[model samples]
Target chain A: MATAPQLPTTRPLWARSPFYFNSTAHLLRIGRGKANNLQELLEALRLCPDSSIFRHTFQTLEEHHFIKEGFSNDFSHWAFAACNEVELAERLAIIDVREFTSIATLRDRLVLIIEEYLQKNPRAATRTAMEPFYLMDSDLVVVPTPYVARNLEEFADGLHKISIHSIYYHFIDARLRLKLNNNDFSIWLEKELDLAQAADRINRIDIYTSTLEGVRQNILKIIEIELATPDSAGPD
Target chain B: MKDKNPDRKTAVEEKNAEKNSKARDPKQQQEPATPAGQAAPQELAVPAAPSGTRERRFRQTDLPARVIERRKHPRISMEQPLPPAPPCLDDYVSIIGQPELDEIRFLARRLRGKTVKMVNSTAVGGGVAEILNRLIPLMNELEVPTRWDVITGGNDFYEVTKGFHNALHGGEYNLTQQIKDIFMSYSEQTRQRMEFTEDLFIIHDPQPVGLVHSKSQERGKWIWRCHMDLSNAHQGVWDFLKPMIEQYDAAVFSAPAFACQLPIPQYLFYPSIDPLSEKNRELPEEYINKVCDDFGIDRSRPVITQISRFDRLKDPVGVIEAYKLVKKYVDCQLVLAGGGATDDPEGAVVLQEVIEAAGDDPDVIILNLPPWSALEINALQRASTVIVQKSLKEGFGLTVTEGLWKEKPVVAGAVGGIPMQIIHKLTGVLVHSVEGCAYQIRYLLTHPEFATQLGKNGKEHAKENFLITVNLKRWLVLFQILLGMAKPNATI
Candidate 1:
């Protein structure tokens, strides 16, 4: 596995709702604590005097193994809803059943697909099963699932680039469906920005993306740069 | 987009202002349209009187003739204190188990020194307040410093917030600048007057959402706990409130789909009921009998009860309509009992509409009890053969949980948090409309064996999911994750 350089200063993915996870990370960093395992994380949180429902709910999930615990005892970097098939199925059943239809369907398909694929090519099926869902766009190819961030810095830098790719794909899809030319980008972009000024429109987009990803990319016209590609194979 | 329709906007604004004034001033109000869609008796426009006055008026209007006569005859003084409630700890422990006890200890160990404060709009009538009344004491017993606070405002604030609530539910209600100004002024006043020293600040619902803006010098984790279902929120309202919501340290929603693409990590917590509370606790047979007699409910006829605030969304009239439909085959009485929260100004009108819809039908009883009438609620639920929650839109019907906990099979709206409890053919039945609700109600009444099984299954499910003991453990784990104490080997 290759790791990126340092954590980026800004992340577009994070800016969407930076407070929850960002504050949790910041709080973990504050107490001079290194929590790798579920137990250790519980130990650190137990130190906090306030009985916040958020912390309590997480602890319950860990105890029940609804989420998968990390390999390291220091749980600074953790995954969201980390779990296995049985528990995942239980969680899935409880979900609102409205959103994530594709993901839900894919999960259902995976069981059958893996079985069939294995019958055809056992070696490849086994290898693919071991590998996670690495993000694959239409043009640019990334090795890791989503974007691989060696550290937080790269994670932040690639946030907007990745998002811009998604945005452009959506824009182009709508444009093609409506039989509109690519020239409609400026009008749509202005409407999206909801601003009077055109000069700093991309900057405003970067801010919007930052809220989603927790940090922003360094490149300002990263949307234009990423828009060179036609489409993406996976969700943003 | 709004700038394009200024004239239309003003017209709607004028209509709302007229409605609001009529709601506030009894003199300007007329009787609500009856069940047949005709004008009915003119109800006095009371300035949304407090619980005491409202209770007196309700007793005068709705209480059984015998009960009223008895009251006048002075058999027992209204001031006579009721007997002390029975010891509930043993029973609570027997059902919910010892983990609750251990979790409380651990919670005390963690939060003993810190203060946890809860802020909401209403203190006496709403579900949040009801839960807090029991929960705060339990927290204190466990040695965690806990306090509950009620945000104060006049009618204008509540009326504006009610509009915001409807808007959040995708209702096409546009609020004016004047209403916005009133809301801001109240928020500002509350921010100045409120003492914000707690380690954890929990603000519930849209009424106090702006309180996060008040956080100046003291910076702690501010959680905006939304109790409503936001899946279909009106775009205009969501767009307006999203920025304010973003300011919170974290956002907590009742269901997963209720969560949006906020940068904050959203936690899904199903609201729960305390089995130990007066409203939820089991009542004696005599008390149940007395309540049944007082409410003019026939003990022989299979009784169906839906206890909820008389809001349009609860569909009280729709509930009666369902009961009437069901009554065509089997003889069953319906009890629609609940009081309005202080914040919902439209409750009285809705209640009146329900009363008129019920008509002179002796079997259909509409009881708008006071907020503190816990024993009455318990009696009603106990006396009920079937419980129905016919809500058009619901966040979580705590009444359903309460009814299920009391071992009554329920037919509820398949919306919001209700589905989180009623598991179709398993625990209880979930219905979408009046016809569906009536079908389920009829099914339960016809099949006594199946109804009993459903009631038993519902109680078991309630024990597993909607109990406060389970809620306490969930909170414990969420805290552990925040403190970075989750097991490294554990997977979610």
Candidate 2:
């Protein structure tokens, strides 16, 4: 096999700035927008606040972090559980949140998916849900934790020590908040440490297939492998 | 961009200019500006006398006979000094880790100066009183300055409110004008007697809900905490209470289904139990055995338990019916342990029915424990093989949370807040009927390994979501939002 070029271990000064670990606790409030049928749901999605879009999609990962089965978002869950719309539910469930950055785009995608489904099955538009879907939004109360990492060794240690909530905040939530295609950890690793290969490896981690704890274990494994590289320095 | 409504924009500009001119005056500048949507403290028409001064005025020799007659009721009792809190913030660090504790402290720091006052119908019985008793002390320990007040009323008042409670839980009530008058009369007396000095007032349940009539923008924000299931509330009772409920700055419900479509923003708050409290604290094997012996519950045989008040809503008769069905398949004993709340006048009647339903069944035991029998209840729960909470209509079903916290397989009714706690065979099994409850009990008794796993998952679920620490965090966050310290919908 041909040998790949060795990457440099040294990093720029900006990349060495410590990553402060933060976590969020949400204060959930019921939004004014509610829907009883598919047509009404489409209207509510069009007019509902961006935070509601964030809540049903991105925040659902944290809320239902334990469940390994079923649809990922509340909309799909409601569609299947309440409306008995299996085909539409599956379609909505497949709209992966990772594809979009801004909540506006995510909302548009949801609207588009529902619209397309309604076009295909016109009767589905008039089908009433067993229970009304009440739109809810959460206010994120972010608090910095004691864990901070200035280097890869400390980053692995911090990841091991921090709560699963912190992991969700940095890995999943930061994607929408930062309006970037990548998560906070990947962004920092590539921007500051000049570790684009390592960042890309992390960015490729399948978030949908695993729990938050599972994600943490995978990240720790990757960091351990990186730390074993010949030129990699131990914690500074 | 140019203003779309030029005249309206100009009028707003002129008003702002006038306000600014007034602000430029030295006298106007000397006074602190009240935030928009908030009234100045002085604008409260009620006298802001210290409680002691108010008491002194009541003792004046020249007081009128009408005043003295009105004082006979003494509706609002001052906050009784609490005993020392058993589980401080540091104590919870063992159950929930240090990071969770630190987060609670951080949220509390934002609400350091604000005062919280919790008002309910009773001071010693029921879930609301028990939570307030522990919560107030712990919040004060966190330096949040919390107090609790119990509103006292005559027996007629309680009877009427009990009817209101049942009606709110979707039971039928006549809801006559007499009932309305009794509710408002007691509420008015409570309003007159109590001092509304706290920065935040939490009016719990419908009994004290009418006190929102005293809400002034100059005073602190008022929140109506509806701890009942109002999804199918009687329209007449709801209409009577709607205006007062709408007057609140916000409303909080135990579950999403418990909320009505009110104009004010509604938040979902799950009621919690104190792990360090006698009702939930870990008990020794010897103590558990003694409790079982005391109740005549056979330890060798599988013991199923349900702990709740002797209220009709709890469905103790339904529990007995389920136990009889399970008895056919398994040689198990059922322990139905509970006491009565002071405000629930119908408990005695329901207790009679439960006793009759369980008549002469050697395998079934019913213990009418007192309110202070926390240790005994904890031991009984710890000794049980499985726990069940078969409520026909429930208010959050704290008993189910208590059972799950003890790491016991729980079979609860899929109503109110019970479903939120029991995640349908994931944490614990949620049953809809006596037959389903019996079926699950028999299944769990037969499948020991799966039962143990459910128990373990149930404990983890309770630890994560239903512990007192999480409830404290929710309150602190709500305080932050109401006090303008944090935005209601802001993201990190």
Candidate 3:
């Protein structure tokens, strides 16, 4: 028997561990997990081609397979399929960066990526093409036991407290504080993001000493704000 | 050989000798025979006017009737049609990419409600004029309400300004009191004769740098946009002009290094090309072929051409040296075609020198055309197998951008904004010397594949960076920033 799904208590709603779990579960129920490798998974998903996101991934995976094949003298149909895949991959790969390795990294990367994608692709909101999912609600479980009504008001109060705790880390200051002990990685992210943001702020960047220091301070302020957010919020 | 036909051979030899002697010194008169047919004694005679003055006359007036009839057809000049007054920016930006569109909108907001009037000497025949002719319309399309005005002057004023130009470019010039007075007198006359609105006024180049004094308290946003390389300008000239320049709200230069330590804020804006313009737009193979045929340039042999004003800074003479070096490896011809600007007095003398240096070489064609010769320049560039711009000093050579847009690989001097356009060995080859230019030309001629690659990359780069659409977008954003309608965005 399969184990029940569990939600992490310390992340934001969008960054929670259960989000991708729910999405993959839907794909698994649809027989997508029968795929033995990334290539197979891409091909299987391509059969239905549910969302533009899925379509983009399928195309990239197909190109990865072709490059690995190294120009085999296959039939025209096979060659053309690879050609189409490579073309699509080339177009989408322009936006691809390093993949996330940890759940926290994934949460951060996904939110940023989705926000940028939405900004660029406003029409995507109108398209009802993205996949949806249903999470398992264990509270609905029917157990063979007598119901006990003990401290109902106390239960509601605890519920409210837990809700606030779940969201406290979402603020930038909270993330900075949590990652303070991991200074190198936090500093690296802060520096990179500050540079990118500052670059987008000015018409032309002055590479003077003052401007460089100003960029550093600007990003550090964002980190400070992250660190000061109430613990009731979730991770950034 | 069996004894030469004595009478026939001597007759031919005598005729050849006469022809050679006449050609040898056409500037001298033929020796007159004495009355008694005796060898005339060499007489110490008074110098007479040049005998070839008749030959030196402009030949355009002496064309045959048929040729004259052809002229009646009303030839299309560089000024013809004027590119249909450029379409509104809305139609252009709508199809442009988002980043580019946003850039235009941002610029539009900054420049909104501002009327910028750019005044330059000579509305044609020079780089500054050619650029303004295109730039002004585009600025207006962005709703900046820009206008271009040309200052008129007589020969004395032009001669003085030409000295000023050379002096500002570090040439050893004595900016005497007479020259200063002459320049000032012309400026004062222009100020009195012309109408200037109380808007953002820009005076371009040293020719009109003194126009700042004409500005009144009501005048807004006075900018002196200098296009010449002033890094090593004569201190005397700069000192004379400094006080008037500081009166402006800001100064604009093509390069940061060209900016002086003026009290006013300095903005560095590189000149750009309009890709959609006739001079730059892609021409079909048939049209390119026709242009070459029409120009009397044979496409069979490699054609190396330099299209620039007859100014010495462009170094048309150096271009010849580079072409000669390349010609040693491959059979090619050189074409130097350009005209004089109204404000540039040295162009005529320099053009005469260029022609003399070129000699009677059939491969060297020097066309001293009028200012309105854009199509001919376009045809020559399109027909060129290799285009070179060997400038001793330049303020962003637009010819490089023009050649690149046409997908013709250029070998240009790595000065000013040239490097900004030609990525060495990529979009085009940027050389520092005539020898380097020659070597690059030879390489491109030898490696057809590399030439094609460079041309393609250059075309794409021009489309992305220097199109009229991009220029208009920049103006719009600049206006927005100036008007306080929007803050300028820093690009990463």
Candidate 4:
């Protein structure tokens, strides 16, 4: 139910947006709490000229905890952000551990992770990390309306529940669970792809995985085209 | 007819004889197990008199050993008359034109005196029932003696079949061993009751697929007409049905994409919409306006609508989310109107979620019509600026065809037979996500000329590809092939 922030029309004072990645304790020094995107969060903490507005907006998680001070600005290195952002990916990876790595390495890693995290909950491994952007028109900071210092505990529980039970999320989970419980995912993938040797090359599945193994090459083509464009540019 | 298969003859004869000797008396001829068989019987053999206070319906009578399977199940042994369509096949001339009518009549010449029968689960309420209501009658008019038979099962049997339906369309299901027994045993009983075959016994979908087990008694051909997406059927269920499906002389799927690996020759045919049906016939503009007024839908604003039975797979909630997105941009009113089918029990639950999602949004209207509201359905389609069929998975969306027949632009899911109908931007738009649905609806509303042109193209496409006349032609050719009058590899 977490909504992405819709930017105001005119240049505003304080711009606050929710950070969407599952943040662990090691990466606590990331967001002031609320942030638009990772780049904005990193900019607010240690990289920006003014960091006070971010500190004020990204307030206590419930009572004590504030947004992480600063550690690694490297988390927003475009790739993960371009996909499900940080918090969302961490939350998702908590269920399907294959998500933690890059797409290129998913096939090899997915089977191993499914074996390890089948019914286990490494909950603390995916602690809450939000990076919201604050709206500031130079002098006065503008507060976004739906801004309540969201409970970190509640958010974490929501992510956990979503990963487990939400229809779209549970689909892959159910498939993965079948794999872990003596069901050969590779053999299933073989019939799914109508492949003779797909079971040999890949024993795991990506979320975008199709019955057609040949289509994986097509995704690479998209990545190539996507990389050619400038950061700000989007698909036409 | 023997390929030196005499070694198997003794075994086949024994099985056939065993089936021929059933527990029923001659007057109680068992009905063929239709997928959409009628639920309410005209006169049932109720208890002679009430003896004592009943705690519940069950534990009241001498309950069967499989009490849940037999008693708790939905009513199975009922019969409904074929809905009235064209009394004479000749009436289609003005609609389909003379050459097409003549063409169908010419094609029907070889099918005379040959028998064809349809086996489905229900005799009322779903698309299969609706189509056979008209198609069977029309075939009879063409001098082919075609019959429609429905199978009976209690409520438990339907619940299991509904699960299989969802699972075949890529939805998850928890099909326990008990439900599997319920499915197989009931199918066995129905098969025993209606084991007789004609020149062609066309079994529709998985409900009566077990009837193929009676192929030993087959004096002629049997065709398995699957009306759902089997591309992602649950592996276990598929494994169970695959052998039975393979035994058929041939199989028919609604789209080429639904085809799966099998040694038997498989044919693809789209489910057709009847042009003269109450739901598809062109309506007067004023009547359309009255439905809008009755539903409290605003005629002034751009109207976006989706009319589907309230089933989870139909993705009514997803449609609501898409409307919310479109509502952010366009000043429009969204209407989601649908009813229930006897086969599906999840309709009420899904309807509640749809209502909750639309939640106090005055612009969003939800209407739950009865199963017989064909005219109201017609009016809604006519009144709509755009019609959306945002299903997560579909078999062949005849509702999509119905909307197209009315020359209304449709936004539908790219799944199932929808892609065969909507050629992306050509006939209509096919959406993969809720956002895509909203974006397409917004685009069409903004660009009326393009939407109108798409609708025109959609109408022409449905006429050529998805009408009963075209379907009739195909069935005739298949009949010819079965009768050895046409080449096995022949195409219409």
Which of the numbered candidates is closest to the native, going by highest TM-score?
2
Please list all clashing residue pairs in model 2, or write none if there are none.
Answer: A15-A192
Off by over 4 Å in 1: A1-236, B1-91, B149-163, B172-197, B213-219, B234-237, B339-361, B487-489
Task: Write down the DockQ of candidate 2.
Answer: 0.31
What candidate 4 gets wrong by more than 4 Å, as runs, is A1-236, B1-87, B153-192, B195-197, B216-218, B324-329, B340-353, B488-492
lDDT to native, each model: 0.54, 0.76, 0.52, 0.57
Note the clash tally of each candidate: 85, 1, 32, 51
RMSD vs true structure, all candidates: 24.0, 17.1, 25.8, 26.2
Model 2: how far residue B20 lies from native, Å: 60
Who is ahead in lDDT, 1 or 2? 2
Q: Over the stretch B1-492, how does candidate 2's per-residue lDDT look in tens digits?
A: 111111213432344334444544545442322212223222112212122211212233343454343232221112221122244467666677877787788788778878988888875446786677667767888899877777879999999999999898788889888888889999999899888888999999999999888887787999999888888999999999999999999998887777899999798788899897767865557666655655556678899998988887788899999999999989887888786633345776676676677765556666665454676788889889999999987778888999989989999987767877876676789787899999999999999998997888788778877888888888888888888887644442
Model 4 residue B149 CA deviation in Å: 2.6
TM-score-better candidate, 1 vs 3? 1
- Give the alpha carbon lDDT tens digit for every residue of B179-231 in model 1: 77898899999899788877667789889988888664554567787888786
- Model 4, position B94, has a per-residue lDDT of 60
Name the lDDT of candidate 3.
Answer: 0.52
Superposed Cα deviation of residue B321, candidate 4 (Å)? 4.1
DockQ of each candidate relative to the true complex: 0.01, 0.31, 0.02, 0.01
Error of 4 at B341 (Å): 11
lDDT of 1 at B390: 84
Can you write out model 2's per-residue Cα lDDT over A58-148, one digit (the tens) per residue? 8877866655456388888778866778998898988778778888889988999999989998898878876678788777767678888
